[model samples]
Target: MLGNVADVAQKEAVAALQKALQSGDVEGAGKAWQQVINSISDKVKTDCEMYNTNQKVLAQRGYRMLTTEETEFYQKLVKAEKESNARQAFTDLITTNGGMPETIIEDVYRELTEEHPLLNKITFQNVKYLTRWILNDHTKQSAAWGNINDEIKQQITSGFKEIEVTLYKLSAYAVIPQDMLDLGPTYLDNYIRTILKEALYVALEKAIICGSGKNEPIGLNRDIHEGVDFNSSTGYPEKTPIKVTSFMPKEYGPVVAKLATTESGRLRTFDEVLLICNQIDYLTKIMPATTVMTAAGTYAKDLFPFPTEVVRSNEVKTGQAILCLPEEYFMGIGGNKDGNIEKDDSTKFIEDARVYKIKMHGNGRPWDNTVAIVLDISALDPAYFVVRNDADVLTA
Candidate 1:
């Protein structure tokens, strides 16, 4: 399957370069040159993997393998082929871009992103794995509906609300010495991948907690306004903030079980619920064993409900945890409708570098309050999805 993809990519890249040259379009030719190099690099990696697998299988079947001299010769052949391709790609790029290193760099950056006409590895594409996502065509007002009920001639009562969709711009850059371009495609590929990964991680971390209406995603912690209170013994006012107190593992089970019950008198199931907490809390408290005994066992690890996921960030406090249905979190990415890479090279005059910027537009918020249950460590017996002054036991 991968071999077929590589073949098609190689053919298309050659055709694109030829067409650009015939039209006397140097920028387009540079882009085509980069595409050819990228495609061949992918193919070479795939071929290397296949070669290793075949060699292993042949040895397992008691077949005679190539001698050390023959093996080294084959490896050298592969290296030469890759280097030959890289040299051609760089030569073509320099010729098309008038031998201006800066111009060639800009074209390479553009091709690596939106202009490549393939799956982009430079952006935060993995956000889809963490939240329910929708692609919006433009920045505009949108709407999401809530659950509806059926009754005899009953009219709908506020079943939907308006949601403003906004886009956030995230940008980062890496400075590469001009001498590094001569090191071949492998070095360039690794350099680009490293910078892009760093940029994506920054965007993802902010998306997880940035407040809404500030040109950022409405994060999970920001959307949750209520939680179980643990201040009954202190007699603090209802809306007053409380300090966290540690609890034993045996006490974790009962408190977690009580969280499954909703105010609607429905027993919320824990089949799809996930406990999100910091790594420190999970290692030192949540998963630890306790001395308390019950019908099932004496350890809290045996009784705690649902699987746990650690978010390696300080946003989740040391003694706090969140119980949530991940499906209820909605994240929508917009912009880049024309699939074009935006670039800025003004920094070259001052810092001898080019800044490649990709504008990412997205917003996120909870689909429903009930699906997000915030649990304060001080108050474990009760959990809250909605803040209520009268229900002081569950409001924090």
Candidate 2:
């Protein structure tokens, strides 16, 4: 009767711990106490029993039950509870930091919604359920599927894997409204872009690394041992290299000659190129222009539609302070059949060719103290090519 009473009391303690840990709205060490208790109940007794059994079986091998080890493991629960309190404190600090409350919320939204097109299809209820699961930081591996779709479940599983890393980088400052209070966009453009770009890169890298046959426990001889190799078989020759030449007046030879060497053994993809270009441009925005810029697009014109170069000669030489020329003067050297600069004939094709004659008026020049003259110069077929237009800027 006494043993049964002890067992009943122990079970009650375990249940209480589990219930406390599983509470929906406990703060600080209160929530952690439950987790610590539950952990102790689940593993400590089992480990103790196992240790005791092993000691009995291996008495000749100097095996002895270490009550101290079990006690130490139990003590870790206390440490874990303390850590939980630390987390709550950190969360409180974020709240009191005088920045954005929605920073974390927006981060959660971006992580859950952006990049994954599935977010568009999933219902709000399922999303909330998933969000709640995320908040709980629990797994459904032991549970039933419930009503969530297989696709959404798969996404949620995958997304959950990265939650730790995502949370580490996503700061509360991102969601804070710097300008208008509570009237700004839900997510900042910079933050959204940052998350999307990182997520996209991660997905791409994972796809490349975890491709078929690579996941075998013992990696044997297989194709794609290295990522650089692409099959040139089946009548597909290697893509031709792109050559870019700088614009030069017949007298002073071109100073720049740029080329993107096919990364040997690397199968080039349109999407990969596009991503590289976007990343390069984003970095370039923060840096000064160098003599030869390594960018993603085909030509200078592609980087900045209708690029131009100017000549400045001192009065002692030509007596002209500056000679301004429209960007059109410097033609895209290696023009495709349709006059548009080629961006890999292998994947994306360029067809339409229309010339724009933009005027430039600037300071300390033949055209001094002025702005650029925007002009659409030339008559050409616009059917084949898509014009890159800036809606904010005026066009002729």
Candidate 3:
């Protein structure tokens, strides 16, 4: 119970710190961060004092709850990452300690999905290194009543695409200030995780939506059927945006319905769909069009002809929205282990800080061209409260 309480407090402090930093309240941020660090320290101290006799064992293991000399040694290691002799000393220490603990890759994935809504929506596969992604191209192949005829079996055809996930590499860097080492590994983990979350979130979501398929993952905005005889584009084809004059059910429903079938004309089952748009467009266009006054004298939003969840992003362009069945998109990302966090360079950032680089192997793409529709909501009409007295009528 106490551990759970401490976790809640630490989370609250971290949230407060984020709020302060986002609002540019430096003083508030400092205070909130101090609280977060205090919570971390308290937790470490509590764990150390749990058995009282186990403190010595934990200290001998050097698991964050270090003595003053051990603390100084850690500081030395951080500074020495730039120096050959210091790095060698630390490397020898690790070699003697039997290397690093292998952290479960799924835990890292859990942190990302738990924090971001869009990440949780699509398919997230934590695949092994160099794993080949076998995608059955959503092609329709229904079993016939009596498949005894060899000619009938020959007529039925299906296709699958093989993707080499090793071709995709996601690299990101996080800057760690020298002062942060005072908080120990507990807080440092949180800091680096926070940095990685935001950085990876922006990069991954952008690529999944409209990334140029040159060296990156192909996205929803591109035609997924380039190799077919119907599509002439050699490279990933750029999809022509379907125009929309308004967000009325009659105007938008048909366009969205067109995305309900596979490239092979198979129907996809869905209860909820996703609407991804530029942050500005979401506020200026989507919200204004979807929001309506309720009978209880309140406002309800995102009310569409279909069950739709809107995702806002700054990466997408203005006047455009991508609507799709999110389940039709597959994203696979994982790495060897989180145990090998290394210094980006054997140098300092000159700001009493250093940058650490993490390597991730990943790939992503929509299942087919039927997965999403690029929409032009540039001229979407802002709904107004209308008054009427007939049965099932709009009222102010």
Candidate 4:
């Protein structure tokens, strides 16, 4: 009967401690701590008293109390109770804060970066609504004479073009069953972070391929206007539809040279350019056996000045490659404006689920028209930078 009563008392003591911790009642917690200690002491006292009585009753039979062992055990039990209370107090303090546990956050961040390499490669800027840049026109200069020529030349002024880019809000959310939150901090963190990261990556890939002009940023395919036709016999409906049939290594040099001479010559070296294409085009067309090796025994990969970045997406067509200057790609990310994670628990009563919503505001575009060139691999004149593939191709 004493053991059963003591068990009930210990359970009540633990419940009180938990209630105090949840309510953040420091004074109540202290009282609960004392109660827990007293409960454990009572149990130890009862056990010692029963042992003593048994020893006395069986003294002639050589029964002993073993008081030293009982004392050590009681001390150990008290120490364990104190340690458990301290841990519970710390956990309560952390939960009271809106922040997640450090270990969970760290693990989520690591997994996100590993899964999406583009997140690291792309530059991000923090701003409120929009980011702007001033593009200067190319200056024209007249020849100067040693002698103050008969007439003084008129002063020429250079003009500047302003590009204003507005931010686009990308959001992803998940409805988690309320019971899932009870699965511990690490499980909850992983579930939420994984969903959010997947949404972010999806938004990024779309922006890279088909961002709407002004409303969003123009993507590489949309920015290119020049289209070359590889099969002249089967002419395309439009001169430049941002589509092509095949690719060859021999055409790389001439195309790069044409891009280098755009808008007062923006490109200096081929090494400064990046070729972005779909993985299918890269494998079946770009890196063919004929292009991979040369008679001189040099690998084609080593000889190319520009590196290729293969992105897996349905946005990019099968035979198109975008040549770009990484430095000219501008991306602006707004941190605290519309970019925030909102928790919606109003549906808890109806659906028994918590909806976590996150919105990320960002905008990206090429700094100038000459920053990127789309190559229609199938066409003879594969190199194109201007947004006029339907019109006649301009000679460099």
Candidate 5:
């Protein structure tokens, strides 16, 4: 799948350049040519910088250098492994420390954002045990604020309420070969990160979109309020999809108006927005609908009436799409809890390897129901670039 291809932007631009050159539109071909050059330049610069980042170095010290106290903490861990069986000693250290160290949690988060485009766009926090904050109840509003009366004072407090964000047990497990564990903290650290991030990239992406709130994060596509459309199989809430036939600006403006405000009808800054769809839908539905030729004549990918950025998540079903401000989604997956790793009794492992279960505490959801809009885009119009017979100008 092109969605799974590496160096995506560069590859896509190169493809577009080839298509543009074939179209015989000199102006569009030139723009596509420029885009190809730019994409390659950026890709090389990014790839070069990443080459210097050694996983072993990061696994030992951390992405952000460990604090003196934390460094000493590891030094003591090294001291604790005086026994010949370093693997057993390390296991004991993990048990004593809750589960995995906070460093691994932080590392996995960094990897998630770096590797996953969906994660990179949203608001993520490494919150503590419990982080309580105030969320204004957009359903309620204060009375007239000009006069300070008893009614006004009483009404003021109704507009907001406090919510406590706490962690829940999101369980996962990883298997490491005995040799790797014997290599001590560095190898274990790297393996733990690999398994954790791979697990989370799929799990979190699915949960953030359609997860039922039963022992998991409430999804952005699900209703925030209680007693909504419930799916018994998965315990997921189903949002009513807005029906739309085309994404052209003339037809697009009003369909997205509902998304340009707070639940309380307050206006929002719309510099950029996120659009998510499954890989199949993106290639067949969204790309045809959103890709438009520019004044320069080169085709643009995923351009919408409002500025948009596209991120693919197979979690989103085919024929459906999600629109929202990326920053409006809130997610926090903190390992700074009473965490621990234990043997998976259910798994019968061979003598060469051992599988361990790791429990992490984390929570995530949209800021509110209004932030995300699910759309029925099965009938979306395909874009076409046409030159007017009378006017010399081209249009998409």
Candidate 6:
């Protein structure tokens, strides 16, 4: 993986630079710099190719792909991060606060259960496993060192509350809707909101399980977070419980959804969603929403093999069409730092053409009733109250 490769390269680069600076090898250092730059360029090209290949694999596997809005927002995020020094800030916080990730995990769970019953059902035992699951180390069967020491748990828990707002703000970068992060001040509240975002996402997946009609007889029920669930009673006879099968390295779920928004009015059409999934590039004249939705529609007809009900009708107003895309899609992902894509290269590689689109929906009813996408532009633009006062969640 690129992350692992980058870690190794970073170590070598630092060592070489340190040596050059110490030895005063001006000429040798210059050559080293060129070598490193070439290596980086090659890596970047390979990374792009890998990304493209992943897209092809997704297509072959019949999975939904990121929308154009998602692709663009992610690109913008990467670009913006390159311009900032916040990466170290985040790293320092995580490291200084007791490097054990469990502290955050426990506190996150505590806040979730206390405020949200749906999450309250999630016990500590299962949560430890879930953490491991996220780490992609499912083989960790036991939370060894069995007893949950109160002191350790408390310290870890403390870290969770302290970073709640930071986590929430960070999640804004994950492309989650800003409305969801509106819990009032206080570490507990912030923590609660952060937990709610993930819990609700799980809720959504549960809905998909019910909607897929695969788990049990699809049934309707109220989820803990107040989301309606389509469970066994609703219809499917053989669907597995909806759960996150994989933890995205960083939150990309919501940001992927935002990629469909475009224009001043920020309108999106069904076709645009489809075009984005297919990776078809078109002139700027082509509305992104139209391109994406059109492609998705065609793909759905041939690829959607299961029984699922997605409302599709031309009679729906443009506003309604725009509304069809999940609100979560408008949220942005954060805490992403490029791990040096082009570290070294002697061969040419593919470069991806990415597009980003932001659409603001002003409820126009109340001045504050506006929906904005905060892709990767953390540097605030205060002229517009909506733009200025908004959280540093989405940019592009």
Top candidate when judged by lDDT against the true structure: 3
Candidate 1 global lDDT:
0.44
lDDT of 5 by residue, 363-384 (tens): 8877777788899988887765
lDDT of 4 by residue, 112-199 (tens): 4466654444555556554665555333445555566567555555445576656667665555555554433323343455455545
TM-scores of the candidates in the order shown:
0.44, 0.15, 0.69, 0.52, 0.70, 0.19
Model 4 Cα shift for residue 294 (angstroms)? 8.7
Give all candidates' CA lDDT scores.
Answer: 0.44, 0.24, 0.65, 0.50, 0.65, 0.27
Model 2 is weakest, by summed lDDT over 10 consecutive residues, at 360-369
Higher-TM-score candidate of 3 and 5? 5
Candidate 2 residue 327 Cα shift, in angstroms, is 31
Task: Compare candidates 1 and 4 on TM-score and give the better one.
Answer: 4
Q: How many residue pairs clash in each candidate?
A: 0, 9, 0, 5, 4, 69
The positional error of residue 350 in candidate 3, measured at the CA in angstroms, is 5.0
Q: Could you tell which candidate, 4 or 6, scores higher by TM-score?
A: 4
lDDT of 3 by residue, 184-219 (tens): 544444455454554466567767777666566778
**What is candidate 6's lDDT per residue for 1-396, written digit by digit as tens?**
763575367346534643463366877755554444334433333444454446565344222334444334333334333445534533343344322223333444454446433223222222111111121111112222536554433222111101011111111111212222221112112222232334333322233212222331111111211133535544322212222111132332443344344322243433312111101111211122122223223311211112112322111112211112232121111221221011111122122211111111100000011112212211212121112222333442
TM-score for candidate 6, please give it. 0.19
Model 4: number of backbone collisions: 5
What's the ranking of the predictions by lDDT, best on top? Answer: 3, 5, 4, 1, 6, 2
> Compared with the true structure, what per-residue lDDT tens digits does model 1 show for residues 17-79?
655644668899768755754565465455545544575643342223444543343343225
> For residues 1-396, could you state the per-residue lDDT of candidate 2 as single tens digits?
432453455445433433342343245324343333333233323333344345454333222233443334323322322454643433333234321232332343345444333222112211211111222212233334656555443334421322111000111101111121111121122222232233222222222111122211000011222243443342111122122222123211121111111113222111111101112222322011212222332223223212323211110011111111211011000101121111111221132211111111100100111111111111211122223445523553
Model 1: ten consecutive residues of lowest lDDT: 117-126
How high is the lDDT of residue 358 in model 5?
A: 61
